[model samples]
Target: MTDAFYDSHCRVQAEKMNDLAVSDPKQLVALSEQRYEAQIRNVCSYICNNMERSHIVLLAGPSASGKTTTAHKFRKMLKEEFYVNSYVVSLDDFYIDQCRLPTLPDGSKDLETVYALDIDCIHQCFDQLTNTRRASLPTFDFHTASRSIITNDITLGDHEILIVEGIHALNPLITEGLDASKFFRLFISVKGEYSLNNEVVLTHEDLRFIRRCVRDYYHRDSSLERTTGMWASVRAGEKKYISPYKCYANLTIDSLILYEPCIFHHFLCPLIEQMDPKCDIYPRFERLYHILQYFAEFDRHYVSEDSLLREFID
Candidate 1:
């Protein structure tokens, strides 16, 4: 049986828990943080301890689900016992340039689909990494509008680990004949644990939508309207390309927390305020404003500017 905490109708029970302790909201926040951290450590330990040989641990996740951040944390833990050398291979870096990629039914660029990546090149990189002692990785330059495979070689001795985190890492085409024992798989998703006044539950996709909106505005030089507009297509691509392969993973990490939205609100609310009142996003702005009202205020005074959350909020 599914834990009551994770049930599909968990929102109603969560509300009951909220009402039962309405006088001590801090207790819920603290307990949620503890659960979140424990989940991170548990996932990391499972991967590091369960592997029997040198294998490419495939960490696949939807966008802004803290895949990159969690990879960093997991590497830190692995280093305590093994001479681990980790490299983050972003699928975004492997994207076929906009000009060369496939066109949508409307003639616009299909930026979110697997067709945007050079799958053959990706297969080559994995083959090289697994077969040879030394390999050079490719780096994609989004700003310059080009890609050049890095020719410098990296040699990994024993007691080393290679972690590849991306949208398609679990896709069979990426690593076809590799032994199952040689490759451990993980699927990560930003399944939000927050709710609307402990009533209307927030879905995992909702958290990702907010994370993408914050990330696109800050890093990709995209506007809230543009990110919100493209989200449906991005989500469709995930359903088609990413979700089907999730069953293949050995582990699934729920990168959700009750506190993150509260933390996110601190940074994202002000940016939403800057949107033009006359724009189409005004209605969304109202919804975002309503959400902000529910969270107890977070003082971002402690949040580091270099933090991954900064990638979204800044």
Candidate 2:
């Protein structure tokens, strides 16, 4: 979609968020959910329209933009609506083990860039999948920080789509020597900024941070200290490596659900309230705590189990 359309929707959603918070909070939740579902359908339609232009989709998004859920949902919609079968693969499984991770000039590990991955292996899998219609993909164990046992070879059925999703999926290095026509490049992001009385309360960055914090703490067993501490480097990596490559995307999806903050505030506020003031990450959490209060929370159980918000809150 055009920048104009995205900006326009951001403004409209912000206004709707503020108004619906008071007049009809329930409607706000339903409408926001509907908007997000429609956006996913629109993305599927776009891909369907250009089916000939692409079969291999490279999907990427920054942390907590719901890239994983989006891919799964997109895959589901493509099958349910269009009767297309697809397979989704992640770059995390392709990372070289932490012990063997590449280092910088100062000898510190450089884990942020694409080079940290088994690039040749990725190319091999992609090449094999496209040419031979099958390849065995590896799995990575985050707890062990190493590649797991290899899985059985997977085959791409005739006329089926293959989706690769990760932060670096759009990087030119991954696409080197690949045919552009057979590949569709898709990127996910949150472009909305929620405001109140003409003052901005939540930014696109803040939305992602909140998502990561909730997911990190509740789902990943990560403390606020760890999540906040790593956020700076994570954002720096996105700016340097991910956003720069978005211009090459066939479509960049704005994955913001305007009502997400409503649900998030319920879970995040209690955690923030318990944060130790003397902690190093307290200041960062304090800022978000202030922003979270602006949102009028609703019953989180009201949300669908399969909702994209579940990616963060589950």
Work out the TM-score per prediction: 0.82, 0.91
Q: Model 2: residues >4 Å from true position, as ranges?
A: 1-9, 12-19, 104-108
C-alpha lDDT of all candidate models, in order: 0.68, 0.81
Clashing pairs in 2: none
| lDDT value for model 1 | 0.68
TM-score of model 1 relative to the true fold? Answer: 0.82
**What lDDT tens digits, residue by residue, belong to model 2 across residues 1-314?**
12222343345334546556667776666766777888888888888787765678899889988899999998999999988888888988899999999886768787778888898988888888767778998888888999988664678776688888999999988878766566788899998887665567788898899899899999999988888878877888899989899998888788888788878889889998998899878887898888877766778876877788988887
